[model samples]
Target: MAPGVNDAIRQLILNGRLNATSVMMPAAYIGADEVDALEMLNAGTTRAAIGLHVTLTAPFKPMSNGFAPLRGGAFPPINDMMRLAMTRRLDIELLTIEIATQLQAFLSAFGHMPDFVDGHQHVHLLPQVRNAFLRVVSEIAPNAWVRQCGRVRAGRALHDPKSLVLDVLSLGFKSQAARHGLTTNPAFAGAYAFTPKARFSRIFPRFLRGLPDGGLIMCHPGFVDSALQSLDPVTTLREHEFAFFNSDAFLHVLAESGVTLAQPSGEARGAA
Candidate 1:
């Protein structure tokens, strides 16, 4: 979304610790230059998996038009979107068009299908939204895996309200994906309070605790720039996460946890 984020991801991929990332097609900085740079970076050797980050929330304009629910020419906030989805008030047809448009943008820019697909704010898990999302992915990029936020193991963070809520919403998601002939990650982690005082170095190890082999851990590591600050409240923490991941301490933590970085397999039973 921002140049800082692009730089951070490029560095992390070069660092050889990160494996996959998703792109926001509607982001302001995502244009010809950025796409060219990313393509060049991904040309040879073992490039990181790139996927579409389906966006249907604030801070971004819709790629497709005729959305009756948009507020001020922008997608509504996550909470409002959730409410609309839960109440069956969302315009599913319009949502599907928007998603398809975004996917088309990704395909147009990358000249290939995404390795996977997921929602920007986990919006793919919402009721009305999930149907539109899955349908679009199945039709446009059937080979891509989808993200499901169900945790397979009970860890200390299991009781955390955010984790519990996501788990509850994720019930029957895997089966839904199967019905659509799409695969999903087995488990998920990496939910935390993005407070200004939070230390990612201390909080990240806990995300690995009890995480299954195929579990996916979400993260947002980036440099702080004016563009990023304008779009997100999760500002400083991105720098913190980037620092931790870029440091030798990250390698030490992985070694201590007996974890090795690897790409998710094609059989849909592993992490990416």
Candidate 2:
């Protein structure tokens, strides 16, 4: 959520290399410049889809009050939040209120509903949290689709622990969305070890191996700055991803993989 990252995404949008991005409504670094850039791009003929990136973890403060579990006005870490969600210990009322607040913030800033909705760190797929998230989206932005991080096919990255965990958590998520009268992506990819030595160029093609049409592939392509380094451990890889996506190699890979970037469409209430 740093300015550098925003710049990278803006460039990607301008170059037609990126089709969609979710904005973190509560990020402190988001200012008028970033909003103006997004507004210009969104209002222009660019096909970029902007959505809300619901955040409920550390390094960001909560938007709603009465979160008894918060620590020092900040949301808990991802692991702790996961435990509470899985065990159904989270206060659903407070979580729902916070999500709605974030959605309102997005609407106030953009003057329109998000094109889609997803969570920061995939929190929208978790247990108690999912119930609250889907309900809020259905109520506040029924036209927006939600992200479902479940894989549709086995591939080289199938064994990756992070992918497996997301798969498990995403089981029945689409059905849940449907019950809420929402739509979700058919499949998902783009999980990898964010290690310093990891080469995004080499790992990205694996995400395309079996991705279905309208599938969603998440990526974090950004530039590193003091703010980014202070808030996240995934610094260098962002630059690596940005380089790959901004390079001819990315075009070659997409051509070789027989892939095309298209905006996902649906008429159902709350489709992604």
Candidate 3:
């Protein structure tokens, strides 16, 4: 998640300072670098889990060897896709092709299915995208894991999400996960915008407290590189994410909250 310095992010996670990461797929990727990184991380048998940051937006380069037909030589911009999703005119066929292609590319590089799957803009929860993504994943890798967008209330510091259209769409996707016997977090953390001045230890506890036990905690940690900054304006945010998640404060939160980062024995994950 670094500003093009993918290695920095991987190093921290491997050193046991961070426990989770997501990958940008078929976008600005130097084909197979992700696989190399994933394999290297998994070799340590670290608790760190890697999921696809399924890319459909972000003005960046698709892996030179990617599987999508870029419209006008760039991604169908994120906003455009949102408009299409809203207008019911998105290119579902290409969406399916892109997801399937990214998954295959990831497997080719890692030699296994991804640890989990999500999306760059929560697009996987959209209708045509969800149906298409589920179909591709279930068809190609039925045993693979997928992330579900689960939100539950502990208190009201975080505003409750109130988009009925989004919820209805996500519910259908959640049901699809159940139908396929996939696992998801019992609750999700509110993704705050990144702040450069933040300390990892200080910021993580509140997020930890907000989470219900056993669901996945998503964090983006990366190196800040000029290339990455050019592509991802929020590179500094993830640097803070890396610093915070790796901080002693986060571990203290885990201990105090009795939150287990990974389930023992690979059993079903749920709220405590």
Clashing pairs in 2: 145-271, 145-272, 183-270
Residue 17 shift from truth in candidate 3, angstroms: 3.3
> How high a TM-score does candidate 1 get?
0.95
lDDT of 1 by residue, 71-170 (tens): 8999999999989988999988999999999999999998988888988989999998999999999998999999998775665464588888788778
C-alpha RMSD of each candidate structure in angstroms: 1.6, 2.0, 3.7
Candidate 2, residues 221-245: lDDT per residue as tens digits?
9999998988888898999999999
Error of 3 at 260 (Å): 3.2
lDDT of 1 at 26: 87
Which whole-number lDDT from 0 to 100 does residue 179 have in model 3?
Answer: 82
Q: Stretches of candidate 1 above 4 Å error?
A: 156-159, 264-272
Candidates 1 and 3 compared by TM-score, better number: 1
Off by over 4 Å in 2: 156-158, 264-272
Evaluate all candidate structures by whole-model CA lDDT and list the values in order: 0.84, 0.84, 0.63
lDDT of 3 by residue, 1-272 (tens): 33345766667766666555667766555456565765576663555666667777657445444435466666777667667777777667777777888788777766666667778767787767777788777787665566665554452343434333334556778888778767665666535545566565565566566665566555667767777777766776766666665667666767898876562222333322
